[model samples]
Target: MMVGATIIDIGTRKALEANGASIASGALAQANDASYDIVSDGGGCTDAKFIISGTFTTAPTENTTLAVYAQPLDIDGTNDADAPETTRPTVFVGTVQVNNVTSTQYFELLAENVPWKANYYLHNNGTGQTLSAGWKMDVIPYTSSPSA
Candidate 1:
């Protein structure tokens, strides 16, 4: 059976606010993971889209898609130590490693279902030459689509 094109255009209001940090060389940061928070008036209880863009001093070996997500805990809790929460969510968006490491390159991550959290981390699944520094992320939350 074949279904005709529904001509679907999920018109949802979305907005992205830039709130991130930079990771120093050999410094563990909470922003090095996947997760998002509510940035709209509709509340951060729904899923939203994401578009990650930044500059990297070091380039990843392969194409990596860093998962972006939101958690219910404050993973950035510090115990007088500088090491941030290393155990975060990386299932939403994956960081795609490109070959451009000289200049600022843009990375796009489109998420559907987002939640209200306080931490977003970048998940690293491989142990290659680690990236040195220079990285930032942009988060955009949108209203959910209607269910038919």
Candidate 2:
């Protein structure tokens, strides 16, 4: 679902390229599409944070808000706020807190090579009405090194 999210390295990283062109080349191209390729080290992991910075074809399911959570424990089942650490992973990032405008809403998160879990939930936070339809979270994972 976050396939559309852009990825960046947190520190020292090698130059990235797209196809036969470097990231700069791609950015300079008419299409202007590019990304960085990062490799991880040993047991040590890196941080991959994501921020909501895109658009939705349609409005969200009316009053429905999307919440992203980190669940490193069990891969399945729903999480109750009570024992989130046991059921859910962690609240590395929260929702926009308010309805996202046509502009852009922000949701942040961090990911590591250590099988960190992630999930999104939709709820009607507005009055009692539902949401529109289209909704999506733009994510970007911070990297440590470009080429390991």
Q: Which one wins on TM-score?
A: 1
- Report the C-alpha lDDT of model 1 over 16-85, residue by residue, as the tens digit: 3344465432333446344344543325445444555555556644554344444444435532212234
**Among these predicted structures, which one has the highest lDDT?**
1
In order of appearance, the predictions have TM-scores of: 0.52, 0.33
Looking at candidate 2, the ten consecutive residues that score lowest on lDDT are 22-31
lDDT of 1 at 111: 62
Candidate 2 structure, TM-score to reference: 0.33
Residue range 19-70, candidate 2, lDDT tens digits: 2211110011111122222233212334544343333333433334433443
Off by over 4 Å in 2: 1-46, 53-66, 73-92, 99-115, 122-128, 143-148
Q: Which residue segments of model 1 deviate by more than 4 Å?
A: 1-28, 32-45, 73-97, 124-134, 144-148
Superposed by TM-score, candidate 1 places the C-alpha of residue 13 at a distance from the truth, in angstroms, of 10
